[model samples]
Target chain A: MSTRLPTFGNVGLAETLQNRRLLAGIVVFVVLALYPAMTLNAYHTRLLTWIMCFAIAAMGFNIVLGYTGLLSFGHAAFFGTGMYTVVLVMGRVGITDLVAVMVIAMVVSGLVGAIIGVLTVKTHEIYFALLTLALAQLLYILAVRDIGGLTRGTDGIGVTRPDFFGIPISELPAQIYLLGFYYHVVLVALAATIVLLWFVLRSPFGLTLKMIRENETRAEMTGVPVLRYRVYSMILSAMVVGLGGALYAVLIGHITPEYLDWTMSGEIVFMALLGGIGTFFGPVVGAGGFILLQELALSYTEYWHFTMGLVLFIVVLTLRENGIWGGAKTLVERLNDRRGEQ
Target chain B: MSSEPILKTENVRKDFGSIVAVDGVSVEFYDDEIVGIIGPNGAGKTTFTNLISGALPLTDGTIIFDGEDISGLQKYKRVRRGLVRSFQIPQIYDEMTVFENMQASVLSRKQENNRLFTPTHRDSASVSETERLLELFNLEAHADDHTEHLPHGVRKVLDVAMSFALEPEIMILDEPTSGVGSREKNAVMETITEAAVEQQIGLIFIEHDMELIRDYSDRIVALHEGRVLADDDVAAVMNSEEVNQFILEGGV
Candidate 1:
């Protein structure tokens, strides 16, 4: 084999740029980490935290729909499973440890994902999407009916903030004093999720997922077990979404059947698309933009849904379906091209 | 050339409802040979290759690859066993660059498709192999070009190159020169056949061009109405009365 690198050139420059991007990412994370300290408004900090949670979920949704080319209309199933697992483990099992609760939630959601993947991965196109919707709706109904009184029905249930490493975050004084502390915890989780997903998207497994997305038949002909990989994608995607849901449960400290509803799934999909479905950091950008937009719309009018919908329509049309981050990325590339020419 | 056949199909049949695409036609393919499959448009050539490649399930026969019955194996499993095939229309990832496309096949060949955390660009072995294939196919100039904008001939070459990247013992090319320009057809064939010979890969290609078939194939398998009419040396099959009457003259 030839020892020379492939003749694409700019290898050294690309590596330098990659390192710069990494440094930039770390700098951004540090700024986000210190934001709560800089801002006195707890509400804004909490909003940012909520955005991070949704970002996590949207990132997970991207793994399957964006990367693997499987559109799922029922991701709320895993997200809701995560939410309910956190609430139930804390309430029924009396687990006061946030770490333990999050772990349990992820495991439960992952199991639910695996089961749903087995049932749905065989179906293609609209059938696969519809099957997921059907399954998620089934879960929603179970939660709504409060089957065996486990979900507490439509009335929902409130969860007190659990202890984090014996920090007593549940106490009122601690809750006020350690509000930034909780925000920091969420920031750390979001950062970790980003790092993990970055590694995944760059990995061989991620490349195969993209192969499946680009051409399933070609991928199969090239020695990829398509069905098995789809299932694996489903499981991993669900676990990530589940982790997001667990964080969301902790952030909101309340659980309801609405969390399990199809609307919630739709919102997750919207978040992914708004940020550019397949691009790295797109989902997070989408989530952050979505939450901020909702917050802004809700403040101005009761017809916020109408306002948000109109904005989304305009954004979609203007971005040409590349999402906000994708659009921004294209702009940057264009600028760099001009600079190179000059 | 070899005493033992590397791939054998025993009475393999494919049916689409009541229509039999491929009849119970048994054939043996040995390593170190170039076999051309020639038939009219609707003949079972592509369907038969599909059966052997495990793209389509056999209706009533068995496919033995490397001395193992691969009748029930998945398409990818057949590929893993080095029975690879290129598509008739050049199936490729339009969104990915040519280099990435070749890298995908190399990754799959190395069984590294499941490496969840190692970035594909960081995979030195697969990357080197991808570069090698690109160089072998003279696709280095277009390595970074997205396949969507590639010429039809280049796309066809990329498809064949991807199959080659799997390091297959036997490679099937379904109308490899179809849709390629007349001027580029010979060049495409020359590149493919030369590479196959260099790598010692048995080639089974389907073609409509009689001259190309006669020039490249060591043997020819003539099919009409899903049945093998003649399976003999290229000269014998080309000269056979049935092949000329049904396939060359009337069939074409």
Candidate 2:
């Protein structure tokens, strides 16, 4: 038997490919970072911040649904849990540190995610989706009813901006400065999230999740503890989404029970599907596109939701289930193939 | 050769609401032997293997592997203890490349599947093991191709190759070359048996091809109607009249 391991022939090519992808990612982030300065439109920059928040949440949704093949329709539970955690902490505990608040929100939401995952990971398909939806709806009702007088009923409550590095954001000289500073905060968060997910998806744990997604039985026979991994994915995904919710709470400066509603869960799913479920960065694209389309439709007509529905229908029909990002990728590939042929 | 059997089942039974698919079958398998299981259609050959691999819960009986009772263990737990199985229909990750398919097994064997942050490609141990298995199975040329697009024979070889990556003390294969053409059956069998002997891993395979069985198996266990009819050396069992009448004559 040969004692030496064989070397991979394509190692150089693979490294070059990875370097190119890293370069592309850096370029994208650079453009995003420069957008506020170039446009000088505080309103538009703030809108982009909103998009980044949803992008983070939708990416979390994709980890479970697209990567692990578990369709969860109650992601709002974690999102809202994070939002509410911020509200409760600032209101009751009086801790207004942005970083501390976000961490607390994530830890609390992750615990909720763990509980839900433990309850629902054993179920499959629509049962899993419905169970999650049902559980989230229960939380929504509790918030609406002001359970234990904590949520303040359905009329909702306002949130004060937390301190950034001990500097009060609300005491800023102008609204643009405030929005710009917050935009950069969210920008940093989104960039960090993208890098984190990139590393995760390339990891062995991530590959095992993909294997489970492809064939659960085969994965089990190959010695994977399938259920345990599913739960871990759920907890990680929820924490990511929960972080987005923490950011959203500060950005919007308000809280409502509707954030926990099943409709919000559906919207999260729509973002993932629209961006192209299973493809990294697709959910981010989906969130930006969905938000922009909704804003455009709302400005044009009172029946904005109907317009949004029609667009979703058209996109689903034309894109062949790849969503916008995946469809665009396929189109580019086909175009390159044609050029090669010519 | 080791004085004690590596795997032993005590009157293992499986029932699907009184159907009794695998009825009170017990067998001992050693780490240095290749055992061929032969039976007619619906003779419970697959079910018996499934019981051993913990794919299905046994209605009754105990399975002791390496002298530890594993009857209540989960399928993946059994695999983690060096008991692994491949399916009849070539169960593989269709979307993954052939190299990745093999890498999954190696990752599991190294207990690295739970690693959350280490890049899989950088895991030199798993990557090299995967490459070695691809070469051993003569699947190196198609390492980059997705399993979905590969030919059936290649997929079969990949499935068995993946099982080999687990470094199991005992490997069970259900019809390892079922879908391959006749011309390539011997080649596939030869590659499998050679790898088995080289690795010093015991192999239990179910096959309908009598010639391949006679050539590859050190011993034969003939099952009929969910019961063992013959358990002896390949030549002795192959020449038995009961084995011939029940399994071979029945056109398995």
Candidate 3:
């Protein structure tokens, strides 16, 4: 018998392909980094900052929704819970550090995600989506009704911007750079999150989750602990979204009952779908498109819902089933094929 | 070969609400053996295998693997204990490459699937094992191709190859060539049986193809209406009068 370990010839080729893909991802993020410097407009900066927050949350949602094929309509519950956790921690403990608040939110939302994931991950497809929606609604009602005097009922609460780490706003070099500084912080956080999620999604655990999405029964028989992975994905997804929520709290400087609503959950799902349901970067694109569309529509008329619905309808009808990113990917592939032929 | 059974099921029964799918089917599978289970559509061959593999809850019976009572164990836990099975229809990750499908199975087997930070392709042990299985199954050329795009025969081969990557001590295959082309069926069976034999892995497979079964399996168990109609050496089981009337005569 030969002592050499056997392998397919294409393993090296696959690695090279992955490396190119990684390079392409870095290129995309670097372009994103230059956005603030190019625009320099405070309004655009704030909009992009909010997009960064949504993108972080949406990317986390992609692990469960895109890779794992679990359609969750209750992601906003985690986001809202994260915001609430941060708000409560800031109010009660008087700790105003953004990093500390983000950590607390992640832990709290992660626990909530675990509980919900354990209960609901067993159900497939529509039922899974509905169960998650119900769970989110349960949290929403608790927040709206103020169950234990924690949320201050429907009136909600307001917050002011806290110091960035230990450096106060006055300690900043210039007044114009203060708000932009927060945007930069969000951008940095978003970039780090993308890199982190990229590594995770490329890992074996991510592959297993994708397998579960493709065929749950097959995945189970193949020794993938389906429910466990689902919960883990949910926890990881929730923590990431929770971090986004913490960032959002820092950005908006307020907390409201609407943050915990089922509509918020639906909005996250919309962001994912409007982008592309399956692709990793699609949700972030969807987040940007969604926020922009919402802003543009509301400015034109009060029927922003109507405009958003029309756009969604058009995209679903015209684009590839995978969504915007999938469509773009297909377009690029077709172009590449054409070029190769020449 | 050792007479000590690797996997044994006693009075295994499965009831689908009103009907008994698998009725009191008791069997022992030993190492270095391929047991062919031949039965008609509703003869409960699949259910019997499913019950043994913990795919379905047992209505009434005990499944003992390696001298341990494993009836309560989940399907994945059974797999961890080196009891793995393949599906009738090829089950694979459609979006992933053929190599990735094999790698995922190897990772799951090694219990390194949860290693979030560790890249799967970078795992030297899994990479080597996956490539070996791919090369063994003659799927090296299509290693980088997405599984969804592979031909039916290749997909089936990949599915079985992935099962082998799990390092199953006792692999139960349900119709290894149910949807495969006529000409390619023999090649698929030959590859699988040869690999199992070389690895010293016990195999119990359900098949309608009598010729392939006779050619591959050392022992034959014939089922009729959720009961084992015949169990003997291949020649004896094939020559049995009852098996001839109920199963073979059914024109499967």
How far is each candidate from the true structure, as Cα RMSD in Å? 2.8, 3.2, 3.8
Predicted structure 2, TM vs. truth: 0.95
**TM-score for the A chain of candidate 3:** 0.89
| DockQ for all models | 0.61, 0.54, 0.49
lDDT of 1: 0.89
lDDT of 3 at B124: 73
Candidates, ranked, lDDT: 2, 1, 3
Clashing pairs in 3: none
Candidate 1 error regions (>4 Å): A1-18, A172-178, A339-342
- How high is the CA lDDT of each candidate model? 0.89, 0.89, 0.86
Query: Each prediction's TM-score against the native?
Result: 0.95, 0.95, 0.93
Candidate 2 docks with a DockQ of 0.54
* Ranked by DockQ, top first: 1, 2, 3
Best by DockQ: 1
Error of 1 at A96 (Å): 2.2
Q: Report the lDDT tens digits of candidate 3 across residue range B129-161.
A: 888888898998998899888889999988898
Across residues A1-342, which tens digit of lDDT does each residue of candidate 2 receive?
133333445657556557766778878888988899888888898899999999999999899988898999999999999999999998899988888999999999999999999999899999999999999999999999998999998889898878867887768855655467888889999999998888898889889998999899999999999999999999999999999988998889899999999999988998888888857889999999999998998899999889878878887788744789998889989999999999
lDDT of 3 at B171: 96
Clashing pairs in 1: none
